[model samples]
Structure formats: structure tokens, C-alpha cells
Target: MTGRNDEGAGMAGGKSPTADTDVLVVGAGPAGLATALQAHAHGATVRVVDRREHRVRPSRAMMLHARALEGLRPLGVTEELLNRADTTPEARIHLGRRTVEARLGHADLPDTAFPHLTLVRQADVEDVLWQALHARGVPVDWGVEFRGLFHGLTAESGGVPALSEGPVHADLQDVHGGRGVHRSRFLAGCDGQSSTVRGLLGAQWRGGPYGVEAVMADLELDGSLDSGLLHVAVGQAGLVFLFALGEGATWRMLATRPAVPSPDARFGQLGPPVPAEEVARLVRESGLGAAVREVRWSAQIPLQHRIASTFGNDPIFLAGDAAHAHSPAGGQGMNNGILDALNLGWKLGFASTAGRPLPELLETYGQERRLAARRVLALTHVIFFGEASPHPAARLARNVLPLLAPALPMLLRQRWLTSKGIRLLAQPFVHYRNSVISRDGTPPAKAWPRPGARLPDASVSVDGKLVRLHELTSVPGIHLLLERDAEPVASAALRTLLPAEGQGPLLHVHRLTSHPGQGVVAVRPDGYVGFRCGETDPVQLRAWLRLVGAAPG
Candidate 1:
């Protein structure tokens, strides 16, 4: 398939007539692919380029939180992801001779369609996104390296500044030793921790590596351990996380040991395969109680927690590991990266195509996602440090788990505690209430979703057919959810608030048949409520629309 689609060039922020694509993504990893797919879904022409010649094959990240699934749902790949994923409804915490089984299904948090933890390989998720992009005739240019950014006048030399406004001019190198320039309206630095784009942008990565070395491998286990249960174990050395991964391997193993003496090792760097002896030692030290029969893939990773100084700098943006890297605690790395991509993806689609420089709209991408990353980083740091810290108190807690194992199941099974814990990990309720674009013109109600909150999924009748609230909002645009009113004038006026066709972000208006309240909730393109009011006051509704850069000037 071809890389560039000239058809959407006009609609895709073509201030520079010579631009090849709307967005130039510099990696084909999950974050990059999701960014490309999301931008393409929202009517932007995207080109994905990766320095690596082949797609990633290892089952690196082995779990997807509910929030990632919810974000991917709007992109139309959640169905395929669910089909290939293994849901672990129960986690078996091995505490010496005693085992504590805790349910993972979000039985207490019923607002979301994905109420359980989704376990799928990172490679599988990438393949699903790749197939989706391929189906749309968007080809990933493999073995293509992003050389630098230069002005169109001096395309051969890297003279252009990274923060230069207007269209971006990027120098690219193909697999065949050919060098050329590919221009786009925007650039996404999803290239990972050692990001060249971030380097070019001079973004400071602030944080240091954790004092723990982790090893992950997909292997066949020769034990009586049940495949359906997520097995977790923590010892004085560190922790072990084992899950059944059915594609090409029976189980995926991730264990952390004391950091070895490696002065040159950096966080987010993947080292060569660990020796069999080391792998055995890792399992033994972590008290996983499993014998590795076969090793399919293995990598040594130095754990670290770092967040970039900035997420976006005008025309240049960063996502995934390029923006933040943290310990693999609570399976938050890949899931957080996907969320970052989805959050920035739709905003990029809106700003790049809005035909005018919406600095306010573009600024919120950094404001919202940076704060989200900071929260994830802080959470993962606490969890990882608590799990792997060599401190005496942490070790004492690990040593005492066996004595408390008898009561742990009952405590973990409590809906109130489990729901709060899962919500913290799943992050479905992450809101942007403080964002400039989010506004609440009505008093906060206890039963209704407020501005900046995630649009909760509910079954509502559409033309006498029951459909999910998300299913209706899945169409690429801002969704205005209005309560069905006997007088249609309010909803009618709200519909007229959308920008003229092709002038701003696409907007979809839907009347909720099951909504008992008399307010309207305007869901942003990224599925967060941007505005909510008791009634559809045109002045307030139009003001919110304009704030999000979805209204014609």
C-alpha cells in the first residue's frame, strides 16, 4: 500500500501545499500506530515511519487496562483486541504455603463496558492496529529513519528549528540508502525513550533509574499452576508477575531482582537475552514456584521513572515512552502510552485541520496529557518501590504476607476496597476538569456525569434499538449527548452550534432516550465530557464549542 493519501491533503491542514502527509509519526510501536490510526480516523492523512525494518515480535507488554481498551474502542480495534485477549478474572497471590485469590473483574465498577483486565501481547495489539491501518491503505514505511527537520527551502540541511510553527519539514532516510524530505503539518515523537525527535526538540527527561533490574520472558512452564489465574509473588529480592499468554507461549514471566552492577545501563534500554541460569535465579529469588521449560523470548530491562519536561512543543509532540518512562507496575506502561496517544491524537487531528492556528486548543494536549502522565508516573513509582524496594520495612511486609494470607482473600474480595483499587489502576475516571476547554455551566449532580469526566457508557435506545453511548460517539467527532425533551428547540439550537462542514472538527449530536435528566453533556472527540449544562443554552454551549476549537470563527 502507498504511504501518502493525497485525497485528504486539502482537509488535513495543507497550509504548505508541498506537504506530503498531515501527520508524520516516527515510530510504529503501539503508541505511534494508535496515533496514526486515530488521526486517520478523524480525517487526517498520517504517515508512520520506523527505523526498525520489521514489526516487533515479542510479547513484551502482556496486559491492557480497561482505560486503554476504552480509548481503543473508538478507533474500532477494541473488538479484535478483546477477541485475542485473555481475561484474568482472578489473581492468585502466592504467599509461601498460603495463596490468596483476589478477583480482578471490576464487579463494583460497572460504568464501563470493559470491566475486567485485558491481557494481550504488545505485539498482538500492534498487529491489530497495523491491520487496521493497512485496511485503510496506510502503509508503514519500514526501515525509514527520521534524520532531522529542515525548512523546505533548505531541505538537504537540518536548519529548521524543532519548534518552528506552521508545517513541519522532516528529513527521512529509507531502507535503500535514499535520502529525501517528507513534509507534514505535524510531527509525533512516539520513537520511545531515547527519542530523536525529543532530542531535537531539546526536551529534558527528568528522573532517574530505579535501583532494580527486571527480566521478562515468554516461556513454557512445567508446573501445576493454573493457566487462567494471574500468579503474583513478592519476596525479599523483588516481585514476580506471571500470566498466561496463549500466542506462541504458555506463560509470560516478569521478575525483578536487585540491580546488578552496570554503570552504562540506562532506563528503557532493552538488553540481550538473559542467560538460562539468570532466568532460573530470577524465578527462584522472586519465589514464583515455577520451573521454566522453554524460553521463547527474554530481555533485560533496567527499570526507571522519568517524565519529559514537556509533552508538546507546538508543531512537535511526544507520546508513549518518548514522553514518559516508568516502572512496569500495575501493567501501566503500554496502557498509559496508548492513552497518551489517543489523548493527543484527536487534538492533533483537530488542530492540524482547523485551518487556523488554535494555540489554545493545542496547548490543552500538553496540559491534559502531561498531568495524566505525571499521575501515572507517581502511581507506578509508589507501586514499584513498594514491591521491589530493598528497604527493611518493604521486606518486612513481604515477609508478613504469609501470616496475613488467610485474611487477605476476604479483605481483597470486598467490593468497596477492590473497586477503589481497580479504579486507581484502570484510570477510567481520569478527568480534565481543570482543563481550559472543560466547563460545567450547571450545578454538579450526584447522578450525572460532570464536565471533564469520562463519558460513562450506558445502554440507550436509538430509533427503538438499544445501543451503547460509546457506540454512538464512536463516530469520529465531538458528540453532544442531549436528553430527549418534549420540546426539541434546545437540542435543535445545540446542533446548530457545530462549525460549518469542513471548517472545524466533526461534531455529532445524539438525543439520549434513556437519560432522565434535563441536561446536555458534550463529549469531546477523545471521549471526555467537555461541557455540561442543565439546559442547552446557546451562549454557553457555543462558548464551550469555541473553546475546544470546534466552532467556526
Candidate 2:
């Protein structure tokens, strides 16, 4: 692929410094960085740009949900992040000064491997991702922004460009008065809501700002508070969440106001430098009034939810907040964005490297992510309002539901409105069924993804040494996990059905029955389960692998 400007010279010409890369990523936040990292691993030459001169001070998205943690495990940073943050096994729900705690470590939910939520500052998480990207030799051009994008056709020697017939070119600009141009097979918009890339693509973000407003701050408390439980207080004063940030320090507060008459106008300017008195009042209302101390950072944010109508427009695609934005009620922003990156990263890398038509595959990004986002929005509303059911019957049920918390474990289990909460609370990962990458098969039903929907992390004995499931399947391709002592016919079938050298990895078959009774599963690069069959059928397995860009030999 090639890029050039005949329009003018430098600033006068409205032309930017022209260069070529496999993929051009906008924004250096968690989402952008994660995309670049994944693309690089897939062997795509990547150039990541951001408008910020340096990493921003952390504020939102401190709670790492189980789904996000699972996604990060493959990136080889989950353990490091866990070491720097506090893990809360309990989610405390407060109603009108009454509190009920749900132990998330319940035995019935054992199907999910990651049961606890890890609380770490967003800055700390960014630092770990940045370090990983840097160590891998991927360059992030900070202080640079994606100005616009244009398309053309050309031949290249590196990875296959997404636009098989021609190369895709992108127009970029530096914040410091210089224009930089990048030519690549594809481009990704990891920029947050109000993304320049999304604007350039002319995609519409349709949704209203939630009528709720809140102030949040990070601080060191004067006294110790239990870091193992997330403390929430809900009342007329609104909802306040106190999360543990480790040490004697804590994420002081995130407080929400009741829905307002004018959603935009309700965002009151809390003064240039937040007053210490106001901070104290917020802490007091959060049930931590006595332990208030020096403030580290604070800001006011209004709740807003929106989803982009499309995630991809040909060579350009969107991920993270760029594709969708929602209220912070469930702490779903970062997790959602990271999962988006993981979904698109492998496909983008593979398409760019292997000469394949990516427009069809790229179209799937919005189809899959938007559905997940919609579900999350629905679930968040339930959590935000269901705590106080509007219907008299539902309200009575809520009151009575707690009473039967013991014997009603079974009845409540079936009617459990909480699974919606858990599904919405967990981060979502996109897999082959959502894209052109997977083998041919009827897509699974639209309920929460089963084992085939998301990846599962297990601590198993590998070669006589303990290792993670992700580490065992580290190649930048699809992996096939078979039960030990299975028929050799199954292995040959997978090879024939999957691409021999497509953007996705060929089959990496591992026998798991050495431990006995373990099920068979296949994992995608983005850490989602691709396919699983207990009793192997060569034809059925072949069909499933082919749908995800795999061909059994």
C-alpha cells in the first residue's frame, strides 16, 4: 500500500507526513492500546496515535469485572494487575439505609472461573498495558490524533490488507501543529465517545444522556475500611459507591443524584478546586464521613448511554467507548471497551496479514458489540431501578424475596433477576459466530454466551508444570482442544475444515483427558470459546470450525 498528497505542501496543502503501516489506531487509552497490542501480535505493523501528551490521571473505570480479567489473562498481565489491586468477593447492596450482601463466591455460580471483581485504578491498568505494548516494540504516537481517512488500492508485501483489491489510507494530525498521514490495509478507532474517527465515518450515536449526575474522587482515608466489600449507600441523597483501592487508600466516592429536569443543566460546576468541605460531605453521605482525608483527584460526570449505529465502515472500525457509551452504574465501561478491542484485534490483524476481504468480517463488529451493549444497558437499568421495583407486586416480591433468602434459594434461583445483573456486569467477548471468521454452523441462541461464547481460564498441569490455558494456546490463531485418547480422525477433520494459513491460527489440538472427565473446548485468540463437543463427530466439528475461518484438513 502507498500514501501521498498531491493537494499541497505540509500545512499549506492540508497534507500530513505520509507513512505506511499494517494498521493505524486512533487514541492511546486502554482500548486503543489493547487493539494495537493484539494487532502487533498478529504480525501487523501498527502505529497507534492519541491526542493526549501523556497518560491521563485515573478517575472512572476502576472496577475490573471478571470478564475483563479473563480477557487480560491472555495478554499475560492479569496476575500483575491483580498484584497491584484489591479483590472484592462481595457486592454490598444498600436500600434505604438497609444493606444486604451477596457473596459472589457462591458455589452454584462455579461455572464462571473468575468470580471476584478486582479493583485497581484505571491509570495503573493503563500503565501495565502500555508497558506490555512497549516491551513488544509497538510504538504509540502520543499527542497525535486521527484527522480523517481516505481509500485507494495497491499491492503490498506484508500482511494482507483488509481491502483485498486495494490499500486503505488514513489521514492523521499531530496536536503540535503538524499533519501526519498513515497508509495501511485497515484502521481502527479506539477513541472514546465523541471519537473523531466515528465522526469522520459519519456513523450516528443514538441515545439520551441518563438524567443522573455524580461526583467522583480518589483519596487516602484517615482510617481503614474493609477493602474486601464494595460499599454502596442508596437513598434520597442518591447512590454512592465506595471501592477499595488498596493500602489505607480508597477510591473515596462516586455519588449519583436523582434524575433531573434538565439532564445537561444538572451538571453543576463544583468550583475550580473542589472545596474540602464538599468532599467531606460526599464522604459522609457515602457512610465514610469519619474517615475522610487528603484528596488525590476528583471530578463530576453525568450518566449518559449511547451505542454507535455501526462498528465498521469498510477499512475503518470502532471499539470501546467509540462504539458504545453507557451509565457508569455497573462499572462496565473499561471492561466493555477492552473486550471490544480483543474481538476486533485478532480479525484486523489476520485480515491485514492474509490477503482476505475484510469488509464482510468487519461488518460483524457492530452487529455483535451493539447487541451486547444493548443488553448491558438493559441490565444497568434493572440494577439502577430494580433495587426499588416500581410495581407494587414486584416491590412486595423484593421485600419478601430477601426474607426467603434461605429456603427460597431454589425459587429465587429460578426467578433470580440477579443473573441479568451478572450478565450485564460481566465483560463481553466477541467470537467467530459473530464474524466471518468462524466455521459454518447455526449461531447459538441470543442468551448469555455459553462456554462456546466466552473463553474459560483453567489452571491445569501442562508438561508437568502448572500453566494457564491462555499460555498453552498462545499462537495468533484458532486453537482446538480435544479430549485425550480421542480419535485421530477428529484431528484430521479439523485441519481440512480450517484455513491452512488464514489470518486465524491453524488447529492446536490439546488432549485434556489426561486429567479425566474434562470437557473438550476450542478457544479463539480473543479468549472466547469457539467450539466444544463432548462426543467428537468429524463432520459436526468440521462444520463448526469452518464457520470461524477454520477448515479441517
lDDT of 2 by residue, 262-333 (tens): 534422222133456776786776554346777776766655667888887667788888888766667777
lDDT of 1 by residue, 143-235 (tens): 678878776466433223644455787877655556666778889999988888888777789998777778888788777889888888867
Sum up the clashes in candidate 2.
Answer: 31
Q: Residue 167 CA error for candidate 1 (Å)?
A: 1.6
TM-scores of the models, in the given order?
Answer: 0.90, 0.76
Error of 1 at 44 (Å): 1.1
